[model samples]
Target: MSEDEHETEDLQVEVAGLLLDHVHAPLLEDQHVRGVLPAPSEAPAVRVALGDRGECAPSRLTAYEIPLGAGEELRTSHDVVALLRAVHTGTHIYLSSRVTSVMGMDLYLVDPAHVKEAPFTTDDWASTLLRCLAHPSEERPGARLRGFLFREGGLLRLYMDSDEVPGVIAADVRPGGALTALLAALPSLLGEEWRTSDAVDDPHCRSLVDLTDW
Candidate 1:
């Protein structure tokens, strides 16, 4: 082949590889979204602080912390997995987002036993969450697990709608918290970076899932 043709072919291959990498990158590896992951055994206990409210731009937000025992830290991904396992043992787990419209929000529900059966890894849990967040109608009924994860100002928010006592529980991502660990582990979990944007017109925002559901 001609030198110029060979060079063109090489360029095409390089471009293809780059595209593949981008397509496979994790959805939450962005520095702004990344969270810390701590060792589960040494992690601090996280208490569920109720009635904690804050403001994020145009709306007032309320956070309902999830209670944790010693060596149970929401700041670590491992603890998060444990929490999910514990909660799912006998009840339904629903993930939901903040109500942005008068029509209300859709709740994503997942099978607890299915999640529990997954390998005890951060990536496994993250994958479970991503699967839950996928387009509900497009997904099977068993995958319609409900929950919400999004960014509000400087805080990363997670909301759980379950059949438990708290009913609707919320967790704000702290430094090195489970939220961060989940986001950090997402890329590895999905084999690609998942991209999201704050712009309302963005595809993520306009679609069934958006930055609000991150």
Candidate 2:
């Protein structure tokens, strides 16, 4: 084997590992419960809302799709500057999306009043989400657990908390109205009794690949 050929093979291995860690692992876990799923052919739309007191009423922002593929650098594509400008200090931001067959929801504990704010650019949702997911600073809180819910066969499966220590729950429910109603009622239902119930599983400590680069 030539030196150049060996280098190329090494690069291929690295890329494969990157895909397994960032893209394939999370979806593969869902597929274990849901069977085969379709690739994300189109970018998902983001829904944003302000968490007022304890009640959260979200509205649809502009529908912007950020590209995600191999050999592509992740950057912000949406007008995040305008959105951040409008957001007040100490406001809790809720971002949710239903992309293809996956429903993902997240919470950002925004503290814009602090000396250092969450690092994000005015470009795309991918960069924003990546920053929130891989945030380094401990002073400012980043993404919190709203969980990712997948539509599997005839059931809806939800995985909450960090990917490493996920709390999973499933139900024989479809998306749209039923799912929306369930999410709306989740706050009341996600108490100690709910966690201890037979429907919810004990935290499965599965370690996901650490996301280092975009």
Candidate 3:
């Protein structure tokens, strides 16, 4: 279907999964809602954290420190994925195919290009994303996707950043269509110019990707 429809579907799945996890593990009932993802449980009993006050604010732009259970504290975006793998051990976090439109980062869910069995080009990727973000909705005329980076594999990364040169930029570690397309476009996407190591080492980029059943 359309990108917005795909995003909505992905969001529904993510929320359902989160709710299911909570049902299985009461300790993780404290759900923090951030970015394009919808607000977590609103019941008074649930400890929910809404990252922004506005409707379409940037998704967790600056990193915040949060506990990863078991006394392990890590930054939200940077260390989350690695830490999640470490703590949860075997949980899987799926990613979408279109690198330009990663679920939860650019949009709230996995949105593949509308074309079937098609290898989406760069232009296709960018335009599809634009349409998805600007899709007309009942609440708002269109979406203005505010965030610049995505939270996948527990690390926050620039939305358009592509890894071409080794060690110059971090590659997409999350398994999804976006990673596949991004890796394919690495040669043209990444730059020859280099920056200091500190520029890429974002602390909030480190978040745990998976949550264990408590």
- Highest-scoring model, lDDT: 1
Question: Whole-model lDDT, candidate 1?
Answer: 0.31
TM-score of each: 0.19, 0.21, 0.18
How many angstroms is residue 186 displaced in model 2 relative to the true structure, after the best TM-score fit?
Answer: 0.9
Q: All predictions: root-mean-square deviation over Cα?
A: 23.5, 20.0, 21.4
Per-residue error for 147 in candidate 3, Å, reads 22
Residue range 104-198, candidate 3, lDDT tens digits: 33332211121122232333333333333334233442112223344443333332222333332332223323533433343353342332133
**Which tens-of-lDDT digit does each residue in 14-125 have in candidate 2?**
3233223222222121221111111133222122322222232222111112112113322222222223323423443434432221233232322223223233322222
Model 2 bad stretches (over 4 Å)? 1-152, 162-173, 192-214
lDDT of 3: 0.30
What's model 1's lDDT at 111? Answer: 30
Residue pairs clashing, model 2: 76-123, 76-124, 77-123, 77-124, 78-123
> Using TM-score as the measure, which candidate wins?
2
What's the residue-level lDDT of 153 in candidate 2?
Answer: 46
* Residue 68 of model 1, lDDT score: 26
> What do the candidate models score in CA lDDT, each in turn?
0.31, 0.29, 0.30
Rank by TM-score (best first): 2, 1, 3
